[model samples]
Target: MLRLASLKFGRLFRYGKLLFAASLLVVMLLNTHSLFSSFQRNELTDRRFLSLNKCPACFGSSWCRKFMNGQLSFEGWGRLRLLDFFNVKNVHFAQYGEPREGSRRVVLKRLGSNHELSELDQRICKRATGRPRCDLVQAMYKTDFARLNGDVRLLTPDVVEGWSDLVHCPSQRLLDRLVRRYAETKDSGSFLLRNLKDTERMQLLLTLAFNPEPLVLQSFPSDEGWPFAKYLGACGRMVAVNYVGEELWSYFNAPWEKRVDLAWQLMEIAEQLTNNDFEFALYLLDVSFDNFAVGPRDGKVIIVDAENVLVADKKN
Candidate 1:
């Protein structure tokens, strides 16, 4: 009798434990508002730290000099993207700019970058300057910036579908400028923008928010020849073709949920863009909020600048 009573008690104890765990999960779900409130108040401050410790700069001048010298710039290859929680390719788009000294081909910009671990920037001390560049770069890649928070609240499906121009058309002035700029490329096969109506134009812009590869693939010419090759040879890609917005960094100032969505969306697009993709290796690494904008209807994002795109592989 005593053994049977003990067995029953053990069953009851297990049931109690399971009930406690379920109760804890519900509490956590309910406390999400408090957690989000706490994160914004403390973690997402205006302060931008270079890092928690000394690190080498990946996108800094040391790597850019390699690019200018016409060498493989693997240092600038993997950039941090929070959404996927991994580093991905960041091909610096330098086509159509100043020709590299020795090579006839154009290279991406040689922008100087200091990770900005400035005094008054934070409580953490400045990083030691003597660390090996490789170690610093690797450390920077490994660090996690996001403070633990609740899952993101995605934009509604109805709103995603509402990214249409039936409600609102893009600015005529902007369209004219974008069209004129594209016409300057004189890319014979790519003048389709001239015939597209405002709705079609808006649709193209909206589609860019998801991925720019389809447009890039479509821009490739049919008949193999010099005119199309020369145009691409000098500057790499047709810049200003896809750029629709002016500033996306401003979205960071919005509420935490909005900020998460904007950053996630941008990186999500970037993750899909293959730098060394296609028959001619296409690298579209030109990234800036200035090259993007929002739809007038549902405020869906768009990328404007395609100039930094590089297409390699064809013997010229």
Candidate 2:
């Protein structure tokens, strides 16, 4: 009887050890799952917050207000919307005025990638009086537009030659045209002030100094029959433009006749841009089908991307 009792006790002890080990394993798995779930939640929250917060600084306050008020909303990238979290283009498509007037599709460009913008911000902060904590307004005020101003004097067009990253054509006439167009569209006093304020204007000047796309679009406005995207307006670092259409690559498998016509149109566009009446030749350094697009309705070929265009003084 003593031997039997001893053997039963040993069996019970081994069973208890096995049960405890199983319980510990289950607890560890559960804890790991909880931790993973928490991480996912935190990541999503951070992305959403960053997207909204960057709007005011990226698009300006007025446009930020429009976004907050639901006057503008993002449009999904079809089935690829799921991967939008990984988008690197810094460009967003949005619908404008779905309630009041007919809805219009527009492209909002951040003008630079995330890494590029971050570097730009760092440079701006370094130049600002506020140092490491400076905002765009402070940085804008710190910019010396006078030093970078192109000559505007009519009497002696060659006397005071100032250079700018905004225009590379080196023509006072082109500079004047750009300035006039910019003022008419962007800086028309109080009425325009409602959309873009003093801080925004300064920011725009800084952008022109950094990237010349805004100035280029204004210099060759779509309204003037230029094969460029329409310069709708800017909020901050972001600029809104009329969405032309899908990229040229999308039409690769199109009808043979259509393909021939598109190729012809592209050649014509290149010819026109190289030898136009503007007295300056625009050499497209990055001439790729991806940089151009076809109009959805008119089937017109347009240079949707002008970031890499170089202007040369033809007369010289």
Off by over 4 Å in 2: 1-69, 77-85, 98-100, 129-133, 145-166, 183-201, 313-316
lDDT of 1 by residue, 204-256 (tens): 33222223332332354312211111112111111112222335766666788
Please give each candidate's TM-score: 0.24, 0.67
Residue 230 miss distance in model 1 (angstroms): 22
Which candidate should be chosen as best, given lDDT against the real structure? Answer: 2
Q: Model 1: what TM-score? A: 0.24
Per-residue lDDT of model 2, residues 1-316, tens digit only: 9999999999999999999889867865767765454434422123243343433234333344454455555654421333344667667777777565778988777677777777766766677564655665445456452223223222122432333333544565554554455632335323222344444444435555556676678678888777888877655456677899988999999999999999999889878878887776777777887788898899998887777666666776
Candidate 1 structure lDDT: 0.34
Candidate 1: stretches off by over 4 Å = 1-246, 275-281, 312-316
